[model samples]
Structure formats: structure tokens, C-alpha cells
Target: MNTSDLKTKIQNLYQDILINLDIEKIDDYFAENYVQETDHDTLNLNEFKDHLQKLKDVVKSLSIEKFNDMLIDEQQRSIFLRYDVAVEKVDNSMGNIEVYAIFKFNEVGKVISCRELSKAYHEELEGLANI
Candidate 1:
């Protein structure tokens, strides 16, 4: 797909799926055979769905701060995004994080897989001064 098409899909995944927790959106954007990769390991579509469900259960609410950058390789049908994520912590505190992700789409314009890296921090930085 084209850059704008890819961007729209990513935005819909974030806005309609992740944020709203709309499982139905998954049907449209994510292939039923989709998978996810992380530094730790890979998860199949069902596993990934379960993972997101668990997070939704715990996080209560979550949001992406912004999408700072995006690159799409039409030939590979891949899209990369650098984004800032902000969320309400489990303890009711606030947290901000940065994430970079690769979204792999099928020839049919459905996301077939994804891989991501994220960096997160809390108040520990300030405490380190006393250490």
C-alpha cells in the first residue's frame, strides 16, 4: 500500500483498536494469522490478542502521546513508526514512554505482523542523584 494508506491503518490500529480496545477492528486491519515479535520472543495472533487483553485489563486506560516519525516501504509492505506513549500507571501515577515499531502488512493491506521496542522510565532518574 501507499504511505498514506499505511499511516491510516496505523492510526486506526491505535485509535480504534488499542485505545478503544475494539477487537472488531482487528478483523479489518490484522490478519487472523498475524504474529508479533519482540526482543524476548514471537507471539502468534491469538497469543498477541491475549497479551493485549491482559494489558487492557491492567492498564485501565492508555494513549499514545504522538507519532513523531514514520517510514513506509511499499515493496516490503512494512511501516515503521517512532512514537511517544503516555499512560496512567497502575498505581494512578502518570508515565511516558518512547516506542519504535515495525508493522508488516500483507499484500492485501492487512497487518500480518509487528515488532516493537520501547523505553520507559519513572522517578528513578531523580533518585539516582542521591545514590
Candidate 2:
């Protein structure tokens, strides 16, 4: 696939799948053997799916507030994205976080591996309990 198409696929993975909580479409964007690494842990495809489901359950709403940067390396078949997220949970807790994510794509354009770092800031809202 071309670089443009690969970029679009990554965008859709964030916009359509992650933000929209479209768990069923996970396989469409991620390779069957995809691996993901976060600051806390590493996960295979199935584990990643389960993680997304748990996130969906906890986060009532999520939005990509800004794309700070996006860099694509065709030779390396990798994409790096830095963005800010606005999150509101079911318990009325809210936060703004910045995330840096790197995606390595397979030859067919499906994401084969990913790594992410999230910088989260928490501010207690008056009378709002975090669950």
C-alpha cells in the first residue's frame, strides 16, 4: 500500500475504532499477530482487544483533541503520532492527556506492532468521585 493509504488506515484506527469503540473492526486494521506495548504492559492482539473493551466500559467519552505531530517513515514502514486526548468517564471524572504512539505496519498495511506512552494529568473535580 502507498504511504497515503497507510496514514489513512492509522487515522481510522484511532477515529473509527478507538474513539468510536468499534471493537469488531479491530481485525480490519490490526494484523492477527499484532503486538502492542504500553508503559504498563505488553499485549498480543487478543489481549489488546480485551483492553480496548475495558477502556470502552470505563470511558464514557473520548476525543482526540489535537494532533501535535505526525511523522511517517516509508522506508521503515512506521508512523509516529503525538496527540492530546480529552476523556470523560462514566463516573463524571475528566482529564486531558497527551499521548505518543508509534505504529509499525506490515507489508499489507495492517498494523503489526505498536508502542504508546501516555502523560496523564489528574485534577480532582469538586464533589465528583472517581470510580
| Number of the top-ranking candidate, with TM-score as the measure | 2
Q: How well does candidate 1 match the true structure, expressed as C-alpha RMSD?
A: 5.6
The 10-residue segment with the lowest total lDDT in model 1: 122-131
Each candidate's number of clashing pairs is 0, 0
TM-score of each: 0.84, 0.89
Q: Write the per-residue lDDT of candidate 2 for residues 1-131, one digit (tens) a residue.
A: 66797788888888877689799999889999999888646889998888888787778988886678999988889999999878888898898777789999989888999898777766632211111
**Tens-digit per-residue lDDT, 1-131, candidate 1:** 88788778788888987778776567788888998776546888777777677666656566876789988888898989988766664557676667678999998898888887666666622211111
RMSD of each: 5.6, 4.0
Per-candidate local distance difference test: 0.73, 0.80
Candidate 1: give the clashing pairs.
none
Supply the global lDDT for candidate 1: 0.73
| Candidate 2 wrong stretches, greater than 4 Å | 123-131
lDDT score at residue 107, model 1, on the 0-100 scale: 85
